[model samples]
Every structure is written in structure tokens, then in C-alpha cells.
Target: MAPGSMGTVFIGDPTAKLPDDLLVEVISRVPYKSTCCCKCVSTRWRDLISHPDHRDKLPRSTLAGFFHATSATEHHRHLSHGYLSVSGNWCRHDAALSFLPKYESLEILDCCNGLLLCRGRKSTDPKTLDYVVCNPATEKWVTVPATKWSWDMSSACLGFDPAVSSHFYVFELVPALAWNPIKRDDYSIEAVGIYSSKVGVWTHPIVLDDPIEILYLSGGAFLSGVLYLCSDNNSVAAIDLEGNCRIIPLPTPHDDPGGPNVYVSRGQLYLTIQGASELSFWVLEDSSSENCWTLKLNISYLRLFGIDYSSSEQFYGVISAHPEHNMIFITKGFRLWY
Candidate 1:
């Protein structure tokens, strides 16, 4: 077997076997198209291809970069999708979408650091809803301290600066209304409360905000060291780690001027009309502004499980939204040699 070598190798001998570690090593370095064919060679090969540590062993930043579809088990309404990783064979995860198994309970904003910044809600059983940040990959969790003095929060974000080369994930807790004892100017995100695991201390970055309120979300992409979010007005907002905001209008979708849009994947946003059959991608060029956004691919799959151009980094394995998950299989998209 050769790394980065395209095409399938058939073991016609019928008794040919490969070691587990060596099989995994070769598959990790090969293209997804070749791996798909090799996985069918044997049950042992399938296990190696789907191994959890296979991602960690390879240069891939994330073992699995696609969203995991988890159901709530209530009415089968597709629950929120999160970063689900395949560990060995079982799918594991760690994401911020850990909502209360019940409503009226505030969802905790968990930081990978040994802390959680949560809003103090006066409803529901706090015991059944203790804030927990569990690394589903390793099943490690940390309970958070009580939030007695923080304001009511609506949203938050978690980020890590590669320049700092830190292992811990830092978070910014966004309060619904800033805490003000004597009606102070506490309505905006003034400073980013920094948490450093190396030093075991949370430092507050310098404060700066034009509007008294954080009018955007911190959930887009850190393309070039900046955080971005798709606004309600079909525009993209870029945010700095220190809580600064800059708005850039994404091009109107398909000239409809009125269509539903969503941030499908980080760095790759998309717009899809509800009743229309057209799908578009938000392509941002390095030398242009948001207004210069271009639409690349158009999905004619009417209402498929939606479009995700951001996940184009690798050959995507999309399970069906219906009963038969094999409707979509891996196609030979990109060929390369390691």
C-alpha cells in the first residue's frame, strides 16, 4: 500500500491480511475515495478507518469535521448538530449546544478551561442542571461555579488564539443586560475576560464597544484571526477577541432580496430559500470586502440535508435525512499524493 496513492488495491488471494496499526497509518494518509474502497475490504479495515485516534495520529486538526445529527428522542425533531467525533467506532462529541433536557433552564456556557460562565436563571431544578463542560471524546467534565453577580446572558463564544499556542479554550460570556448596581454603563461587552490555564488566572482584556449592546453573535469563522457571525440582516460581522465589532454586508442572495440564509460551516456560509430550489455559497476573496462575496456552487438537490460548503475541506460523507442513509456515497472528488 502506498500513501497518497490513488486507486483501489484488491486482495485477490482472499486470505491476504494487514496489521491494524499499518492499515490505519496508510488509510490516514490516503485520500477519502481510496479509503472508502479499502474500508469494504474487511471488518478489521473498517474499524481502522473509523478509529478515533486515527485523526489524532494524522495531521488533521479535527478527526471528523462534519456535524453529527443527534435527535432529542421527544418528537424526532432534529436536535442541534454539534462537533461529533468518531472514537474508534462510536461517535463522541464536545460542543456548546448542551441545552437542558428541559426548557426554562438556562443552558450553561462551558469553557474547556476548568470553568463555566453561565447566566443565573431563577427557574428549574439547579441540581438536575448543574453546569457541565464534558469533553465527550474523553468523557472528562468540570462543574462550574455559581453565577451570583453576573447579568442575564443570552449568548457567548469560545475561542483559542493560535499565536498564543495555548491548550485551553477561552470563552466570552455575553450578558443579556449588563450588571449595573447604580445603573452604570454595563449593557455592552466592555472587556473580554481572559482565562489562562497556564497561569490559572482570568485576565480582563481592554474594553471597547461603540453600541452599549453586543448586537452580533460570535459563531462564524476565525478565518484570519478574527471571529465572524452572520447577522439577521443577511450581512456578516467580524469581531475581534477584545470585543470589537465590524460589519460587512454579504451580497444579496440570487437577486431575490428576500430569502432565508444561514452560516452552514465555519468560513463557508450559504443561503437557501425556503420555497425555492436554488442554493448558493458565500465565497469571500482575500483581496475584497463582504460586498464582493461571490456564489460558487449551486446545489440542485432541492431540499437535501441542506448545503455545507465549509465542510468542503474533505470529501464529505453525508448520511441521508431519511431512513436510507446510504443514498449518498463517497465520490472520487479530489485525488492527490502524500
Candidate 2:
């Protein structure tokens, strides 16, 4: 271990052409800020070290405010019941997976800024609601204004813009008088409440039925602004933040609907078609105006053995065509064979 002014540090031999495994091992040593700066050492190190999973693998040395993205499969337990199983560096290092205290369930997931919004995750702070957001990497944190969920999700979001700092607000929920608790009445937010991270406060509130479909759904996707499933009287559409509603035409392939559904990979959409004798996958190409999906690859071995394509989201960035050997190994994505 090499000692440094900032903190105790370890340096891997920069000259040694370490294999992939050893390289990742060297990167696993430093804490966050130093790790960020150490990225300047070399290109290969930067690539392996800069990965999100690597950053997340760092220890969460905070009381609260570190939200982790987990696959839906993980049940009520908060310690990432199932997730990317990257451990034991290729050469010699400890496990790359993160192991933090199990109690911080209220941590919020902030992908862009790498800040986590959370309440208390430990048993010690269970009594009261504490508003917080933190960057687990640097072990830095901040306190927010509110941690109450008295109101419904309210088709809302935490957003920031040039005119206003960051804050939380409902997306499109309409406002109305609070329910007369004594009498019968409906309570709603006339406007969604926007929360600003930088400003560290929530705007007044805004409520909207934003997505006619969002009403039917359980939750919303936070990426690419937000994708809300909405249904009008006549049409069902996906509404983006810009108020642009794009209708996704449900495909009715002449073939069996029993076949595997379509999925996204490498930024393109693909459909997995099952067959009695051979399995075929079609790539949906949007290179031109005509929206057409063509059979791209076929694997003959699948005829002898059944195949199921697990997309990135499903398998923690690892693609699996078979279920039995779920954690067999990681390999460079296979080239599709048509």
C-alpha cells in the first residue's frame, strides 16, 4: 500500500501489462475521489474504472442518501437481492460487488448526478423521516426539505431547469382544494411540486393526471426525462416530457404470439422468434422511413436446445440465452449469426 498526502493509497505497477483481471484489481483499491483522479493513469484503466457498476461498488460510508438501482426481481430486501455479480478481479483483487448496511431503504436513485436520495437506511434512524440525497462515491451528502409521501406519486418528478434551480414537483397533476376531512372531498395538487437538488427545496406543488395510462400503471421510468404510459379515450400513447405523445403500434406478427417478445440491445430493437426446428431473431431497423423488421440471425443449435434472450436490463448488462447457467461466466457479447 502506497501512502499519500490525501490518504493511504496503493499503486499498481504502471509498467506491467496486466491482464484484464489484474487491471480491474488495481482500480478496486482507491476510494472515490482519488479513484476519479487516478483515472488519468491510462486509457485501459480509465475504461474499466469509469464503469458505473465500479463506481457503485464503492462503499456507502454515509448514514443515508444512497439509492441503488436494482432489478425488479429483488424483493422487499434492500441489499440488492440480485444484481450484477462482478466479483474477484481477473487477476487478484477482492469482490467488486458492494456490501453496505441493509437498512437504508429510502435512498433515492439519481442516475445522472450520481447522487442518491434517501431517508434512513440504518436501524438507528428509524424514528423520524429525514430528507437526504448523497453521493456515495465521495461519501458526500446533503439534507433535503421533506421526506413525506402523504400524497400519491402525483405524476411528478424531481427536475431542474435554467430558469429555476432543481426541485420536485408533480408532472401534470391538477390542483384542487384539500379534502374536507370532516366532509367528503378529493385532495389533489393543482400543480406538481418540483424539487431542485441545487436549491435544496421543493416548489409549491403541481398535480396532474399527466398520463392517462400512468393512471393504470404502477410507476414511471425515470430515464430519458420520463416515459409515461397514457391512454386517451381513443388512443394509448407514450407521453414524453415535451408533451409529445407517441403511439406505439402494438405489433401483430402473423406468426405465433407465443414467441418471445422483442427487446432492446445496442440501441436497436430486436424480436426473438421461436420455431419448432430453428430459432430466429429479427432486427427492427429504423434506418429509413419504412418501419420494417427483418430476420437477422438464426442459431441451429437452438433447435436441439431451447433459447431465450435476456436483454441487458434483465441480466445486469450480461446477455443470457439460457437460464440454467445464469452465472456461468461473462464473455464479450456474441456476434449474431443469421
Candidate 3:
């Protein structure tokens, strides 16, 4: 059989026999699309292709670019979305989500792996919005049913790891009016709305215990089966798939001007704190119990950006960390650096 033509070959001869090891090697050499199609050839072939032992040999997905929303200024009335291709080759994919149903406004809320979570406002009812999960590569999407507290959601996040499961999940953090008599003005996250693709429905919101308020702009990190968000109380709030929750104190000083940002890299949860003159990176040793952080890197702004730090100007903000490497991406002024 011709190399990289496993899909056509296997479909043509379903009964064709080959050693399991050799079949795995051949399938691994083909394109990812062909590898996925090979799973339907037979029970044995599907088992071989799905085997965890052969995962390292399989072809992996490539980074395309980034999706960003345009900020609305005095001149612009509405927010607009756009895509930036890593290779500057935009022709390969459709940046505009033209395949989706029409909506009054569509905002990209969060992205995980290759999927995006969007909020689409209905044209008929401008006040009502639906959550949409879409795969830009395949130009396919599904709208998630709204929960009772969907309108009260303060933030939403996408959780998807192809290696972990074929399905994806949407997590919406719902805020509640402060019931504490002492802190009436303070808002606390009271529940989480979880939607699983496999079930095709949004489960009832799971109420949280000792709920804390989260910084909506700080973003969040979803690692393993839990979601971690930066809390206003100078700590991290972790919520798992079962609705179990815990709060872990921040490792760095709470007075840091840059605050703390959470990220996931190499199957681990990472946190970065920016100080007056330096940036520090930390990795959670164990999120389940210990909640200890190990300082991974500490670098001065002078050495990193060749710029002296001053109280007058904010120098940089972290974009994200490389999922597979020790490197990180940050933005300084208008330029992005790693």
C-alpha cells in the first residue's frame, strides 16, 4: 500500500490482515484526518488506533493562530471579532464564523484546544443569549441550552482535552447577591453551570460552599478535571467536575500590582505573579490536597525586556504559557514576546 494512504487502503480491503504492530505504525504515519477515519475499518483497527501506547507516534494538531475581539471605542459602537493566523496564511481556514446561525452579536468567551465557546445574542430577543460551542476547523457548531441562571453568569470557560475525551465541557460561574450581613456590596460565586457535550444538555447549576468572588478579567485555568480561578481574596478557587470546591491562598505577596494569573501547561497548573521589577512563575505541586506551589522561574524585567521598571508605567502582561514547553508569551507595549 502507498504510504500516507491508509484510509483509502483500509476502506478498500476491510478483511485484509496485518500484524497489529505494523498496522499501528502505518496508521501513525498518515495524516490525522486519515488516522481518524481508520478507526472505522474494524474493531481491531479501532482498538489499535485508540491505544494509548501508540499516541506518541500519532500526528498532532498544529497551532493555527489566535482569535481576538476588537475593543469598542467612542467611534465604534459594537465589538467585532477577528482571527490572526500564526503563519500569516488565512486562506486555509474561515476566520469569520459564517457557518453559524445568524445572531445579533456573537462574542468569543473562551477557547480550549481547537474549540471556541461563544455567546450569541438572538436577533428576535436582544436580551436573550445562547452559549455556542464551535470547531472552526470543521466549521461545525452546537448551541447549548441555557440554564435558569445563565443570565446571572459572571464568567464562562471551555474545558477540552482531546487526549482525555472526545467530548468538551462548558463551565459558567454564576454570581449571587452577597447574603453576608457584613459584606452586602461584595458578590460571591454561588454556583457553576456545567454543560457536557456527551449529554447534550446543561446540568442544573451546582451550588458552592463558602463561595468567593473571582476576578472576571484574570481568566482561569482548567487542568485535569478541575477549573481554577483567581479569587478577589488573594487566593485560587478550585472546583472539580463533581462540584467539590476549595480555596488555596496565593503564594506571592498579595500587594503585587500585576496580581496573579492562572495557566495550564504540560498537564500541570501554573501561576504567574508580576512584581515591580520581576515576574515569578509557579507550578502547583498538588491541587487535590497539598496546594503547594514550587517556584519555577524568576526573571527581572531588565533582563527579560531590556527595560527598566518605573512606577509610572505598566510594562507587560502575560498572554499565556506554551502547553508543551517551559516558554511563556507576554506582551510589552504593542509587541508580543516569548
Clashing pairs in 3: none
TM-score of each: 0.52, 0.37, 0.75
User: For this target, which candidate reaches the highest lDDT against the unseen true structure?
Assistant: 3
Could you give candidate 2's per-residue lDDT for residues 134-170 as a string of tens digits? 4445555555554344232333333222223343322
Highest TM-score scorer: 3
Local error of candidate 2 at 185, Å?
17
Task: For candidate 1, write residues 1-338 as lDDT tens digits.
Answer: 58888868765734346666776777778654566676688787766666776745443322332333344677653344455333223454445435323323344443322223333333465433333334444555444333332334444444443334543434344442454344443335444443434565455543445322433322333434455544455455566645566766656633332233333233343433222344444456542453566666555432343444333343322221111111122211332111
**lDDT per residue (tens digit) for residues 1-338 in model 3:** 76876554344654467677777788888876677677787788777766777766776545557777878789876677788754222234566687888898788888887788998888999888899999988888989877766665656888888989989889977777423235443347777778888988777778887786777467787888788888888889988877778988878675565578999888888999878788899999975565598999999888987776554365588867777667788878766677
The global C-alpha lDDT for each of the candidates, from Candidate 1 onward, is 0.43, 0.38, 0.77
Candidate RMSDs in order: 10.5, 13.9, 11.0
Badly placed stretches (over 4 Å) of model 3 are 1-61, 87-91, 177-187, 288-291
lDDT of 3: 0.77
Worst 10 residues of 3 by lDDT: 178-187
